[model samples]
Target: MVAISSPGIGSGLDINGLIGALMAAERLPLGVMNARKDELNTDLSAYGRLKGAISDFKSAMGSLGAIDKFSVNAASSSNDGVFTVGASSTAAPGSYSIDFSDNGTNQLAQAHRLTSLDFADTSSSIAATGTLRIDLGGNSFDVVIDASNDSLDGIKNAINSATDNTGVTATVITVDSGSRLLLSSDKTGAANSVTLSDVSGNVAATLGMTTVSAAQDAIFLLDGHQVTSASNTVTGAIEGVTIELNALGATGTTETLTVSRDIGAVQENVQAFVNAFNDLQGMIGYLSKGDLQGDNTLISIQSEMRNIFNTAPTGLGTSLQFLSEVGIKTTRTGELELDTSVLNEKLAEDFNGVAELFAHDDQGYAFRLEALADRQLAIDGIIDTREDGINARIDRIDAQIENFEYRLTLTEARYRAQFTALDGLLSSMQSTSNFLAQQLGSLPGSAAG
Candidate 1:
């Protein structure tokens, strides 16, 4: 008989399959390590989500921490067609009578309409080549025209792209006569009048540049006091108020410009804060009910946040010390609800008191929340620390898994060698038993003869 080369060939037993089942049992530690790694990764992801929610809540609190939000002012013009008004926090509540002479004009310098020349094709080269000097408000710059950029469109592009153009824009327009290059100055003051001179090659004269509209000032009477500005948008005419002159009103007709506290904006900001808090609370509730259920870290964060809502703000020696006074209250489901009617009444009754309650530097609820969030989201804070611990555990588990795999590989090899040797031993015993039986049968054949 030929020597059996494959395991279990002589014994007719499934030795390799037996070894595989045994190896599977031996790799039990690997399964445990994989489960542990999965848990750590889940915890890290949960912390990441919690951190983001808290950061959003912190940003919402920032709006309430500023007194400016409560002091926002709304300005209105009686005749909006004449002008639009805007007010800032610094604007004092008042009304002004504003009258305009005309719609303020911008300083315009146009190249005289060229009737004889026809350069409608943008690629057509200009007959002139030289450096054109442009002056606006005493600021001077030069536009260089050469064969490379001598076309009408090229010249337009050159002037617009000048480094020191300083509020000058150039455009090519097609008229009944021909193509005309128009240069307009964005600066409206008389001091910013546009002037072009051809230093060489008669570039300016060939282009027929001339001042069409003279630089003028915007004249308006604010409370019967004549106020002049270089631009249509006038600032500093009144403190914290910007007057945007659109069109001239009827002669001698005065419009009322009213500035008042914007109570609606204050209410909206309060509502936004409440919404943010509720969203964060909902996220926390959801996370706690899932993979992070019974997690002490999440429980502690929830407890701290809820405690802030339950406790009255300290150091605010005012009637509006608690959030409930401002119409913000917590519900049984751990979300914030806002009562707009009550909030509006409180704001109407005592605006300053309400402002101080939320914006006080030391004792305000928003300030406290901001500080708490900043601490928890800091680099060495609770979320980061918890994440680091989870990562560390995961790394340790990875190392253990590697070691366990290596040990399992050795265990499988040893088991395979032992089983193969047993198969050989069993085959040899069977061969010996068969030979002895054959010799006994041959001796008994003499009696049969």
Candidate 2:
């Protein structure tokens, strides 16, 4: 509660007549108390943001446990030496050959051999009603051809729109002043084949090609085993990876390739952790730096807050200590620096140990540290306490003012009543004395006569 000095109306009142002096005495302490309360409120709010960010950072660490760091290299490629490449950490590493041939698996590659199709002549127009049929694996579809429009471009768009199952694509090429509709599978290997039927006007005649092409399966040399696939895409070939065919044919010779996890993503995770730690440190530093000469109450509370961070909570994991173990050293300027190469090497050697350091055993030191940081940073925890204290002080001052006002009112009323009675007694005494003196003087003269 606030304590104020006695006012002019009270028993212990300082009767300094100067208005400035009186105003200064009342306003200065109130301002200080209010300022201290505001500081607490600001600090508390900052704490809340920090706590949330820290919690999220910790949660992100927990999620990191599930990610697997991997390294892979090519075992082999097909005999046809010129090979396509696809090796993601999420993909299985094994030798695969994309072929346009038949096997037991669903074909990833679909081949369409164009026959007497309508886009044979350059200037010819086929109606939209005219249908172009292409077989995608066993499923076949008739595309509504747009011949009145440019047949060369329209054929590509039409085939693409007609089928969802057709992994292969279509195009029209003009050679020697003649247009031909060309359909090719988007995926590699034999399974991605398309066979075109039902055509009109010189398309095959222009190309000089015959016998519609059939779809073939993918052939892979899996761990030295010759495996054939009827599909261009394969899943679970290895865990956490999928393969999509980008090109066609088995080049005669096999090649070796290497695959690994994305290093950039791992680096980002490390940086996030570093940022969160720095934020926590900054918040603590701000609260600790208080004006010593000004009101010491705020300073005292801030000191206590600093102490909360400085002490180590028991039951926390030793692994979670950042300052000593991870090679994060403080400079003379009191800023942190990380030995990244060393840290990375340690992480590579024992990633589990790195994880253990950040994660506490259920309800361990790390968790406790997180909780402490949360409370210290939260607006309600710090600001609310200070504000409440200031308000209590102000209430006490108001009460004191009320008591002083009550006593002054009663004393003023009694003084007025006593002064009135004294005036009457004085008046009566003056009149009687005057009359007695005059009579005494007159009686002496009469006796002489």
Best of the candidates, lDDT: 1
lDDT of 1 by residue, 361-396 (tens): 766777778888898899989888888888888988
Worst 10 residues of 2 by lDDT: 65-74
- 85-178 in candidate 2: lDDT tens per residue? 4554455444343342233332344444544344556445543335556665556776655445435566567667764545656666677656
* lDDT, residue 258, candidate 2: 37
Each candidate structure's TM-score, on Cα atoms with residue i matched to residue i, is 0.84, 0.46
State model 1's lDDT: 0.81
Q: How many clashes in candidate 1?
A: 0
Clash statistics: count for each candidate: 0, 56
Error of 2 at 194 (Å): 2.4
Model 2 earns a TM-score of 0.46
State how far residue 434 of model 2 sits from its true place (Å): 55
Predicted model with the maximum TM-score: 1
Q: What lDDT does candidate 1 reach at residue 165?
A: 79
| TM-score of candidate 1 versus the correct structure, residues matched by position | 0.84
